[model samples]
Target: MHFCELGDPGELSPSQILIRTEFSGITNGTERHAMLGEFNWNHFPGRHGYQHVGIIEATGNEVEGFNTGERVFYGAYVGHRAWHIVDTENGPPLLITLPDGMDHPYCALFGVAGVGLRCVRRVRVRPAQKVWVVGQGLIGGFAAQAARAYGAHVTVTDIDENRLSLARSCGTHRVLDACDERVFEQLKEGGPYNIVIDGSGYKDLFFDIQEHALLARRGVIGALAVRGETTFDWSMLHQRELSVEVSCHFAVEDLTILRHFVREHIIHIKPVVSHRVSIDEAPDIYTILRDRPAELLGVIF
Candidate 1:
């Protein structure tokens, strides 16, 4: 990847805003996919990043509800730079204004948190339902918290012991290491889960859940991961009439609901930001995430 200087943004349109980056978030999963040529637009020297929080440097004459110097968070297809010219009319307003005392680093989690929230909502989890989130990365972690916040009995699983420990401390009902030989037995002790969310982005883990995990009759299995080709257990699903859904991305409405949750303190995001680094260290950060995932989590740039 290479960086080149660009001309200064000038002559904003009637409904445009110029933003100066304050803090940006690196989406480890998707960004990694971009870097490794797995993403659809995997061309080299490409821009990659979605989560960002910045101060408004200037606004066009037609801009409303936003003023210069105000802080806001945005999700753009490419937003790893120091400045951006955002047009309001060309797209729906996905920009969210930040409260005065909000933490900038936490704002970076908005995109992933919104995705998690959507996954939890898609399954229509009810209070007292057993919910299992099979991963503790940013998306899985947030999904688990959302389930618990909505009054479900939430369990979290991860192959990494540290991540599982962190999830337990962060208020998950139970935490399990998926690699344990007795993981299925442990899960059975609490009875079958009503909703099983796969956020590990590992296709093999999803198949394992289909083969080993128990689901109540007509129970839903949510796939919150980037999917790949895999062999599924047809007989088991047909016998149970189970519902399998794949949840990805987010809608504008999801962000609105997440903003309310943030305002009410229903989902505290401070703990999810496990690392912070400058944007200039992008290369080194990518290396760390690729080689040693356990050493990092949410990284704010």
Candidate 2:
């Protein structure tokens, strides 16, 4: 990925706010997908990313509740940049003030974490239910936490031991090594999960779940990862009466709830952050993201 010299954000309108970005988070999965042209909607010379934590540099006369100099987390369909002009009154974008003394760098992943929160909410996770998350990337890590916060008995699996360890530290009830030969047997012992959240974006894993009969009757499958297509045996889903749920980008309501969770320390962001680099190093980071994703998580600039 290459950075372009976008000209300065011009003067704001009466209902606008100018934010000077302090940190912006890289969305590893989505950005990598875009770079690889995995999505049909991707185009040449496009911008990607929606996470930004910045300080309000100035505000228009009609802007209320938000004042100049306040630190905030704002998300829009914009690229990683130094400045953002937000129209609060007619918004496709939204911003929220940061909590007192919240760590600025960690807040860069707020949008990523919000996606996890939205997925759990969309799948309707309930207290005391068993939920299995099949990945330990940033989104999966946060998904495990969100499920636990919703009172589910959460189990997370990943081939990466580091990620599994992080899941344990995040208070997951169980962590399984997907690389283990007997992993499926182990999963069967924990059988008939109430919900299975696919954060791995692996079609084979989804097929395996069905072939192994891992889900209970009427179990919900939450597909939070980006994938081109998912093809599986129809009989398996038909027999179990299973339902597949998909969630895209998060809503402002999801972010509001996520902020509360982050403030209360219910969802840990710092542990998931494996890299922190300056904006100048972004191109190099994107190289690593495309070539060796296993080496990174929660990268901020």
**Top model number, lDDT:** 2
Best by TM-score: 2
- C-alpha lDDT values of all predictions: 0.82, 0.89
lDDT of 1 by residue, 1-301 (tens): 5567867887899999998888888766777767777866568677888888899999999998899999888877774888888898866677878878666668887888888989999989889999989889888988998898889999888998877877987789999888899988888786588998888877666466666657878889888877667567787688778888878777778877787788778787877777788878887888887777667778898
Q: In candidate 2, how many clashes are counted?
A: 0
Model 2 segments more than 4 A misplaced:
none
Count of clashes, each model: 0, 0
User: How do the residues 86-205 of candidate 2 rate in per-residue lDDT, one tens digit apiece?
Assistant: 987865457888967777789999998999999999999999999999999988999999999999999888999999999999999989999999999889888779999999988797
Candidate 1 segments whose C-alpha is farther than 4 A from its true place = none
Measured with C-alpha atoms, the lDDT of residue 129 in candidate 2 is: 95
